[model samples]
Target: MLDATIASLSELGYSRTSTTEIVRRAGVSRGAQVHHYPTKAELVAAAITHLFHEQANDVANRLETMSDEELDTLDGIDLLWGALGGPTYRAALALAAASITDEELKPVVTKLLREFDETLVTNFGKYFNFNGEFESFWPIGLRFAFSTLSSAALYRELGLEDRAEEIVTVLKAMTSMTIKQMGKNSRQFGIQS
Candidate 1:
């Protein structure tokens, strides 16, 4: 059911996703779906939560194999773009936008988003390497990285693959510069290497 909801949101979008479509895609009865999720918002929220966990775990696993020296903003942006900027993110985005006016789903979606942010920060924080006075900028840097990369989804959907790549390349370069500045600032602040 959750899989179907994600698929529906990815392909059909939020306003078009219907219980009938979800159940049909899931190859399950309406009763089965209703028994599990009493409302569409609940089902969609759960789907978003499920995908969030999956993506978070994938990132954590990828990071586990890498040494600190092997990490950089360029590689980190690449990972984040590939990991969080495709169909899964599109699906989540749909639900997130819908949740704004969807009173029933708002709480669930907001809670899940907060949890996802916390998990992402905790899991990927070390790769950022913001030390000393640069620490406060860490979250803003990540938000910049993710929001910039994730924005490319719309371009890709519009068949603007080249444009999307161009934008990502530019953002990746800018992120590298920002990371370098952070390191320089940390050193200037007497943060030992």
Candidate 2:
């Protein structure tokens, strides 16, 4: 049933997905689905939760082989930007798009955004060991990365694809400059090129 929900959500937006569609796609009786999910809301929520877990797992897998290392804000930007530009990010965005019309699913999008922003800031401050302190740059760096990545996603939607690398490069440079200025504002941490 959960698998069915993810499939349907991936195919259709959250709002367009119904219990019937999921059960139909899953080849399960409505009774079986109801027995587990009880409500469409619950089922979709589960699908998103699954998506989140899967994404985290993928990140862990990617990091698993790397040497123990900290990721700075720019590194976080690169890591996250690269990840989201991949298939997982694609599916997650599609799900959230469909869910936008659904009040209950709004939290899923909010959760993803909150996690993205907070993780970028926290990991950057602690790991990646970027020199500049978080005070001057965390907020701006986060917002800039978010906006740039969101635009990169939009670029794909607009059929102007193949520019993710270029876009990410420019964003990295911009983020780096922001951090450079941050050095003057803070002595907490700073990463030198």
Candidate 3:
């Protein structure tokens, strides 16, 4: 039910969504929703938390099961791109954009990003070495992920196929290089242990 609400947020955006719509889509009574979440903010917070946790789990599982040959050939940027450029990814973005200016929704979105970063550190950073943790890795990593997707999605939104491809190419190269350098640094520092 909450998942239904979160999924709707991508299409409806934050300011537009209401408990009435969520209950309508979820096919549940107001009493059911109220039983779970007394306020709209609480519902949105849980939905954001759910998506962040789900994506983190998905990435962690992928990282864990993958072998060396897979990681060697795998494009980490694609993993990020696939997530951010997709419908579900944009939902988080839409929520974030709305949350920034609206104090009412700030905590939910802020915590969602924190959890996302925490997941990244717990999963990907386990294989890397960094000086100030998120200060170093997130700038070259998650921030890059967000910027790259914003460009790609914007190009596609504008119907510029050629420009989008070139932008993606450059971003992918930078991402690959960062991953490679981090791997080397991780090994040098024995971060795995």
What local distance difference test score does each model get?
Answer: 0.77, 0.66, 0.69
Error of 3 at 72 (Å): 3.4
CA deviation > 4 Å runs, candidate 1: 67-69, 182-193
Error of 2 at 168 (Å): 1.3
Q: What is candidate 3's lDDT per residue for 1-193, written digit by digit as tens?
A: 7777776887788888899999999999999999999998889888888888887888777767766544431244555555555557667777878888989788777877876876766676654334443346554565666566667876765578688778778876665565456545443332222
Pairs of residues clashing in candidate 2: 70-128, 71-128, 72-128, 130-190, 130-191, 131-189, 131-190, 131-191, 132-189, 132-190
Task: Pull out the clashing pairs in model 1.
Answer: none
C-alpha TM-scores of all predictions: 0.84, 0.73, 0.76
- TM-score for predicted model 3 compared with the true structure: 0.76
The TM-score, computed over Cα atoms with residue i paired to residue i, of candidate 2 is 0.73
**Top-scoring candidate (TM-score):** 1
Per TM-score, what order, best first?
A: 1, 3, 2
Any residue pairs clashing in model 3, and if so which? none
Runs off by more than 4 Å, candidate 3: 127-142, 154-162, 175-193
Model 1 TM-score on a 0 to 1 scale: 0.84
Worst-scoring 10-residue span by lDDT in model 2: 183-192
